[model samples]
Target chain A: MATIATTPVLPATTRTRRGHAERPSAFGTAILLLGVVYCLLPVVWVVMASTKNGSELFSTFTFAPSTHLLDNIVELTQYRGGLFWLWMLNTAIYAGVGALVSSLVSALSGYVLAKFDFPGKGVVFGILLMGVLVPSVILAIPQYFLLAQIGLTNTYWSVLLPQLISPYGIYLARIYAAAAIPTDVVEAARTEGAGELTTFFRIAIPMMAPGLVTIFLFQFVAIWNNFLLPYIMLGDDHLFPITVGLSGLLNQGATVPALYTLVITGALLSIVPLIILFLALQRFWRVDLAAGAVKA
Target chain B: MRIAFKAGALAAVAALALTTAACSSPASTGDTDGASSDSGPVNLTYWAWAPNMDKVVDIWNKSHPDITVTVNKQDGGDAAVTKLLTAIKAGSGAPDLMQAEYQKIPTLVSAGALKDLSKLGAASTKSDFTAGAWNAVTLGSSAIYAVPQDTGPMMFYYRKDVFKKLGLKAPATWDDYAKAAEVIHKADPTQYLGTFSSGDPGWFAGLTQQAGASWWSISGQSWGVDIDSAASKKVASYWGGLVQKGVIDNDPMYTPAWNAALNDGKQVGWISAVWGPGVLAGNAGKTKGDWAAATLPQWTAGANANGNWGGSSTAVTAQSEHPQQAMQFIKWLNTDPTAVKALAQIANIYPADVHATDSALTTAPDFFSDQSDFYQVAAKASAAVQPFTYGPNVNVAYSAYTDAFAKAAQAKQQSQFLSALSSMQSTTTSDLKKSGFSVK
Candidate 1:
């Protein structure tokens, strides 16, 4: 049965690949190349700009590389006694812990909604869908007020707790759970004397591993790049994420010159972790695509 | 199924309980009283953007162990004020003190974000600052809202090499300034004397202040806005005429293009402030010794009138639990001889204290190393600044100026510039009325 399920997916994948290989449209290729350049030019500009010192930044050619990348990094690191690193660490904690906990919650709620029959389930899911429709930016001010009332506005929890319940993540998980976890498999685990929690942790989770990875990466990148929530919630520079910290460096008021070189260099360094994360988790995405094809 | 439902419900309740528990514990620990009991050491947080301010505060922290202050560096004026107002409205998380721009004082005070320093015995420091600087914080009232930290007495910065090559001297009058603008632009089409920056309403405000125009004034409980007064119109049309004739550039300052213009000497002059040297040295390092500072050109020849461009004051927040301690730190930060010297040397600000000249400012800033009497020119200009009052709707007026004059500057029309002033006046007055402040 497993062989039968897997065999058809192979031909479907190879056939699409062969079709693309045979008739590659020039127009389509050119459009995609345009998209690639559009996406990559700013990144290239950043990489080139980061290498220049303060004077060379404006004087030299826009794309020309210089020798001050290391020096710029040193200056940025030394700024206010390595405050850049503190912001980096703070960002990591917010994104890492926030995404991890959020994904787990998403998984639990998603599984229960997908596999069980319960009263008021539709209402719960509908409210979540409504939440997904509401932009998080609109909620930031209200969330700030809520956090302020509780005296948590400047704390890490102010940023963290508001992000713990991502409706879109839960919605994605629900859809993934319904598709990935077969009802028969859940029943078989129950018949084998597994409790619901044990069944979830053992059989269902392994089956939903690829989907959970997608949800985790989504939440991770979303929280990592989030600016407004943290900017509004936190006041202490020590607790600020990388986005807000770098912004402060650029806007040092009218009297002082902005640290343009440091900001550019900091921006370059900030993206390194995100790139590394994408590269590491990219294989799971490929696996997910193939798994979806087989299941279908 | 029932058990699963029960488990999920229990988890939700537990999560909520944990949040409230975490929140309530911190709430209880915070000091709620307005009075400074001073039972123990006071920990004050200050939001400021001046560079190396932490080092300046370090001296105070070392000497005054009982009331240690932490400086949380923030972004420049508008962002800091916006954050402060948000914190004030939220009823929590505001710092003990904030660095407020001179114009922002009225807005902050009207919002009740600031404590009246007059109540905190800050009135005694009045002699330390110039009348113009002092009046900005007091807003023509007895309530002292802030203590002036730095003053940006307006000055003209020109490239000495470029001026000499063009056979021009620093303009002594607005007419001479206009003639020089034409001469430079006629000599080199790529160059102009200076740009009309619609983006900076404060810079425009300063120019008008030099022309003896006060945009807003308080009488009784009402505000009288005269944004389009004769003095302001004279200042506006003067620049507009030059921009229309294509003798002056309409591009704004503090941009990358402007920085490049300063570096390569494509732009010969800048109408900047006392702290212009730091910006020049940072942006145009190649043209360091080539620049010179002079007083702003007068409307009438030999007149010594000037205006302020950018400056800030240290203000204690109304939400501060220990107002007395916060005021003490602010007083020391601005008026103390040791602290003022540190502000000049370490923070590189043009200290607002009149006594800053006697000891701290013995030498010129590095960019003006050749101009030995730089601060003397700045001091003269500082003393000459005419008092100008800012209203609670200065932000609305400023943004209106940007919108209206940006079009005027773009069209390069003298008429539009004059019309823009009227628009700013109307917008400002209407906004004041809408915000429940009586306007005359």
Candidate 2:
């Protein structure tokens, strides 16, 4: 055994040095815990606060929970035949499908700018970068007028169409594609008689999958939390999202105090679906600045 | 795998097609309802803020079954105005019957968004309503715009028990009112004889109106500002002195501090409009049988002290298809004594109609206690109300005067107050001109 140990192909010195370096540093653990607590504090408060009655909401300490959660939910369900549920369904349709369609357009548009040598590519990229700074709210009134010109105001398309063009998503996709897809691999695929579209489908897309997941998540959350756009665009109550619906209930609470519980319960129900989606898809999120920096 | 994705895409396409098909059905059903493109049961949608309108709608819905009435409950004043302006710009799905507040009619009319209702059928009932109330809905001599629904008649409300304990009688003159405050404060170091809130523009307007000062005026081509008028200056100075002397507490609505003060009965009296009993009932357990009502104290003794505070009117929009049906509902809600009485049961909205004052509902005892007859007090105050012109920029003038008066009271900024008042007057005059109101 001593003679056999005389010559090992790999050196023990390098392996030992790497092993003794560190075992998950405490600083990294602390930083991650701090980040999580910062993000979840508001949500924790909302969950506890929803359980309290109106008097308890103001009288008790901020985060203390009371025994009114189920009672609040039942009262909210009885308000005008559960119109709150209609708002929830409307919000889901707006965010879920809106984000999905936006992701596809962004992915395809970004892939083109990254892989192809198109005319005026620099100018196109510059215009897209400019779009990132223009706030969505500023465009709402103008968008409303434009839609009204063709008689589309108060329609689902008025909201859904304006959100589809996400310039930031395109910018992210282009950056991810440039780093993730290897140039030599593309050349080799081409030499093997694979067409451009074929190579893109089989190779480039798979490499960009992780980055695309991050893009989809960003777009989903942005659309889910949007309120002002829908508020300005739609006039019909039946077409309102959860945010608008909850606000109407809150306004009524000013004159009638009993509606306060309904507002709180509606607010609680509104955020549950988004939280579940966030938790389930969280593992796919590559938080590293460079998700494409993997070794072949 | 590609075929499955294509199938999913096809399904989305099919869904879109179905929704498009569904939207067209409402358009086609219109012809069958005997609504010729022009004269069929015109869909007149009404937007009202008060809960009382719900009772009025139930009555109207039974009579005018042909006209489809969709009631959209909206907040009154600024919030409602914002929504209306946005809807008008959108040019579709506008409410047919819209409720406008007393002070907001001029601002709304100037925006060119309302129907010219001078020719509407409610014209004959104009004389029957209170003079001050009808004046708000009429812009000029010829352009009568809306049907008056409710009126606010200002009065002084006091805690009868608190007054008796302090051994003081309710003052009939402004001087006596001041003396009573001193006596009450001497009796209990904590309690003031009355309360005043600087933040409320409506309260400031009521004070100025009680002193016989017009907030806005139109003279040929220039507008007159009344912030510097002798009557207004006296009213502001008297209230400002009370604030400085520490005999009055300034409390806005719904604050924790305000709520606590209300429950403790630190303020023995309050001067508010016909619906102020609503405010009293809001704090039910705090002041059950302790309250009493009287006419407001006068500056020049035996003056017209009563002034309107909050009221509303209903008008049909130009876009409405069923004008007849909408008017049918509006007339019932505004002029009918039975309907008005039924509404008063649900909400404390005192009707503008003189006949409504005679209703048996007005004699109903207080729900909180049997010690007071609120409707009689409101009716007496209503009979003494004085009308003032609310120009196109009435709100702007109101804010200007309130801010100036508050500064003078809160900070002792006399020179600054005068300058601010003049500045606001000039700005309001210009704003009125831009809005096509003859500012002179």
Candidate 3:
């Protein structure tokens, strides 16, 4: 069974007839490895390229690292009175709070739409689905205009408030809540003299914690990676996220070539936190995936 | 849960505010101590994309301490324009003083985004600058919108070494230029005479402008669109013929391939503006001291006429709260010899003010190594650039025209080029009309 190479290796190894299917196919592994390399090539390039000084950046081969990483970081830190750190802090606030609130709202709404029979439930779900289809680029300018009407254009609320109503997060939450939590448990909690809200928070929420974690992670990464909304909403650079701040740096690099090294180093520094975050939250993601497999 | 989420959001906001205060508090990126000092009678925000403008602005601030002009750097041309547009539509966040490219002036003015500076004593500076530079910022001969800042009269920059080796003289007319293209390519098939990019409408507009094609003009009260004129079509066909024959390279400029081409002497010349010397040195480093500058070849024999490519003017926005102080700074920035001299040192282009050309600045660019006498030729060409008015939706028309022109340029079809020209004119006209502008 271990030597078999005729078909994809399957997890169901005890069945001899389908054992070859359980084996990982070389072609699939090659494709996935290629995907991983494709995703990481830019990260690796930034890490290595940030080590070179100004003149050496253009002169050297891209993958070759030099000894200017500390110098580059120092320059970036001194850039605009350490504004790169401000961008990092702003990004955390925008993504962290935005994801937490959005997940809470999505869980509540998704639980209601999934378990409770309410008027216009189908209409609500249809609208949520339609929201997922509408592109964010189209929404961003109009959002800017609407936010402008209330005098909140350059404020933190402008960027955070729009991202909190992520329709995709709600859609995922609904499917996950319906699959992960059983209706009998909700009825049993209600029958035990629990109110609807109490039943939801006490028992159903605990049952759906894995699903909510998945939603939170989804919303977190989405809000962190968002560029256009922040670029449009914020004029003050101090309020800018790392995406917009690095973009501003990269754009200015055309005139000032030395800023290119700063941009590379800034980019490498910006991603480390996100990698750490993904690693920290990765266990819940695995559990969610396993729960999803059982539900499937 | 809802209350907890609110608390979390509030806590995050509080932490961010603390961080912000720890690092300069609203003046993080070079506001020049306005909020802290609180001394100026008027505080004006200036949005400009030019590099090293702080020195120029700092000079002004030192002389006049009553008014403080805080500099906000925009990254590029398109982003700044988009930012301005959004700010104008939103009716807030517009900078008091912003540098607008000469071509974008009309589009911005038509949108009623810029303050009419003619009333603000803009007319007094009219005699101080060239008509080609001054006319770009003036609207309909009465209302001026911006101060003339810089000019980019097109000049022929060539590899002097390559031309000498090929026994080629600088072409004096468009006919001679076409002939030289054929000769250059026939001599060395691997190289092109020059790049004719489809992606850049500015280069095309400059050529058409030099060809005596006025793409638009104000007709009484309504705007006239004439991008499909015979003169423009003729210029298009001329480039099309060369592209079809494979004599001219169609690669876009400022890319890795174009840089390599210029560096390796694969492209013999670039018909660029006063900024060419600086850019050529910056990008094509290996070709130092090998290049020389000449005025663009005439459309008619011995005409000595040229076209302008890039220039910008500083204007006061309509949203500006303090227009008087704004104009005071603007006038001094453009007219004062001290400020202009400071600007010319690092600006890398010919100064728009006629008085700004001092002897020390004219010696030679280090990149050219004094071999070419580039500035003298560039100045002569600057005077010859015919006055042309850019249309009111200039940037919008450019994006649409670039797309259609790219298809035509790639396919090498004259009819396609003409059709694209017609469609561009029609679409721009109707779109402007739909946007409530009076179009003829």
Question: Best candidate per lDDT, number?
Answer: 1
Q: DockQ of each model against the real complex?
A: 0.58, 0.12, 0.14
Candidate 2 residue-wise lDDT, B1-440, digit = tens: 23322222232223222222332243235324424534545556677766656556766677766665676665344556666766655656457788777788765554444655544466777866877777777644455667888777777878888889877787888888888888887788888777556556676677778788777764543445565567666766676666667666544444444544545687677777666666565443357678787778877787656777777788765445455556667777777766777657665577788888777344633632564466676677788876677765667776765676556656644444455456666767776555443434
Residue-level error in angstroms, candidate 1, position A160? 1.3
Clashing residue pairs in candidate 2 (N, C-alpha, C atoms within 3 angstroms)? B35-B40, B42-B322, B219-B440, B221-B440, B222-B439, B222-B440, B223-B439, B223-B440
Would you list the clashing residue pairs of candidate 3? A8-A21, A8-A23, A9-A21, A9-A22, A9-A23, A9-A24, A10-A21, A10-A22, A10-A23
Per-residue accuracy of model 1 over A145-199 as CA lDDT, tens digit each: 7888888888999999999999988887888899988999999999999999999
On residues A22-70, what C-alpha lDDT tens digit does candidate 3 reach at each position? Answer: 7978999999999999999988899998998765666668799999999
Candidate 1 vs 3: which has more lDDT: 1
Put down candidate 3 lDDT per residue, B1-440, tens digits, no spaces.
Answer: 23322232232223222222332222222234434433547778888767767667888788777898887767666677788878877767778898888888876665456776765688889887998888788755566779988777888888777778888888888888888889889989977879777666777888888888877787555667888888888888888778878888876666556765776778878877777777776556777878888888887897877788877899987677666678889899888787777767765546788876554256667777665466667678878888687876787678877788878878876677778788888888876676555666
Ranking by DockQ: 1, 3, 2
The list of candidate 2 runs beyond 4 A from truth reads A1-71, A181-209, A248-269, A286-296, B1-39, B52-55, B155-161, B168-195, B254-256, B263-269, B277-295, B300-304, B321-324, B363-372, B398-423, B433-438
TM, every model: 0.92, 0.79, 0.80
Clashes of 3: 9
Error of 1 at A7 (Å): 12
Model 2, position A261, has a per-residue lDDT of: 52
TM-score of chain B of 2: 0.85
Native contacts retained per candidate? 0.76, 0.09, 0.14
Q: What local lDDT does model 1 show for residue A94?
A: 96
